[model samples]
Target: MKFIGEFIMLFGIWLLLTWSLAPAQVIAGVVVTLLVTGLAGDIFVFKASRAFNPVRIFWMIVYIPYFLWYVVLANLDVAYRVIHPDLPIRPGIVKIQTSLNTDMAKTFLANSITLTPGTLTVDIKENELYIHWIYVHGKDVKEWSEAIAGRFEPILRRIFE
Candidate 1:
């Protein structure tokens, strides 16, 4: 049952990405989807146990604006330095702790931190996240991690495991 559902979801995504409901297109989708399912063979999986949870996942959709706002703020901060002063940049590497228990949540947090300007996730050592911040505003590693964990963890926990 799970296998068929996975294949169907993949097929639907393929159709949406390819944008063709024609017979040949549908056939191609099924073949590709089936091939992926066969290859995955239960290895590739959703962390969340439930098949679906739209209500709980609703917060993720609502979080898009906030995410975008943060991204924009980060970009503006980067742009200001590029355009003004003598490029005041205080480069530093800090170990940030992660509260994300699952791989899915941690991956999302790492990717989110990297995507946000002025900061890049250099490495992840178990529960600790190593980040390279262009400017160490507070000179506090814990504070940076708190900032990340506070803003992103809740949303990821709701969406993923």
Candidate 2:
């Protein structure tokens, strides 16, 4: 069941990317997706039922736009800093703890942080993620955690946990 789910998801992605209904293209996508699913299906999704849950799917769809908005905002902020006369940046690494229990949830949080223009995820230890920020606005760990990972955590929790 897990293998089938992963294969379907990956093949859907391949179809979307290629945007073709040709028999050859579909056959190749099936072959590639099958090989990938055979090799990594176990690591991809632990629970097939949860992976296909309606609420989680809804949250995942919602998360795309929410994440994109942050990406745009971060890009603008980074651009402004780069083009500014003084280049005002307070670069520092701060640790932010996550309440997300599952590894998938944590991975999503880390990737989201890294994808943002001004913030990069340096390391993740247990429940805490160390992030390097272009400008460290938050004073303490709590503030930093709330400022950096807070926005994405709830949405990810709903989708992955």
Candidate 3:
């Protein structure tokens, strides 16, 4: 089941990237996607049922816009900082613990943080994620975690866990 799900996903990506219905392209896509899926399907997808869940699917769809909004906000913030050197940049690495359990959820969180312009994911140790921020606003670990991961956590929990 995992293999099938992974194959479908990889093939879908291949189609989206190639954007062609030529027989040769599709055959090549199938061959390549099958090979990749066979090699990494287990690591890529832990559970086929969870991957196909309707509620999770809906949240995943919703997460795209929410994530994009943050990306836009971060870009603006970074642009402002670049334009004005007078603004203080309290750059530092801060550790925040996540309540999310699954490795996939943790990975999504890390990627989301890294995608934001003002922050980058440095390391993830178990439940704790170390993030390098352009400006650390939160006073403590709890505040930092809430400030960084708070918005995404509940939605990711619904989607990935």
Please provide, for model 1 over 1-161, each residue's C-alpha lDDT reduced to its tens digit, 9 standing for 90 to 100: 67877876787799899898889988888888889989894885553334467865686777678788888988998999899869989888878887778776788788889878688999998999988888876656678777655688877777775
The candidate that achieves the highest TM-score relative to the unseen native structure:
3
lDDT of 3 at 74: 88
What is candidate 1's CA lDDT for residue 98?
76
The regions of model 1 sitting more than 4 angstroms off are: 41-43, 47-51
Cα error of candidate 3 at position 29, Å: 1.9
* Cα RMSD for candidates in order: 2.1, 1.8, 1.7
The superposed Cα distance between candidate 2 and the true structure at residue 50, in angstroms, equals 1.7
**Better lDDT candidate (1, 3):** 3
Ranking by TM-score: 3, 2, 1
The segments of candidate 2 whose C-alpha lies over 4 angstroms from its true place after superposition are: none
Residue 47 Cα positional deviation in candidate 3, in Å, after optimal superposition: 2.4
TM-score of every prediction relative to native: 0.86, 0.89, 0.91
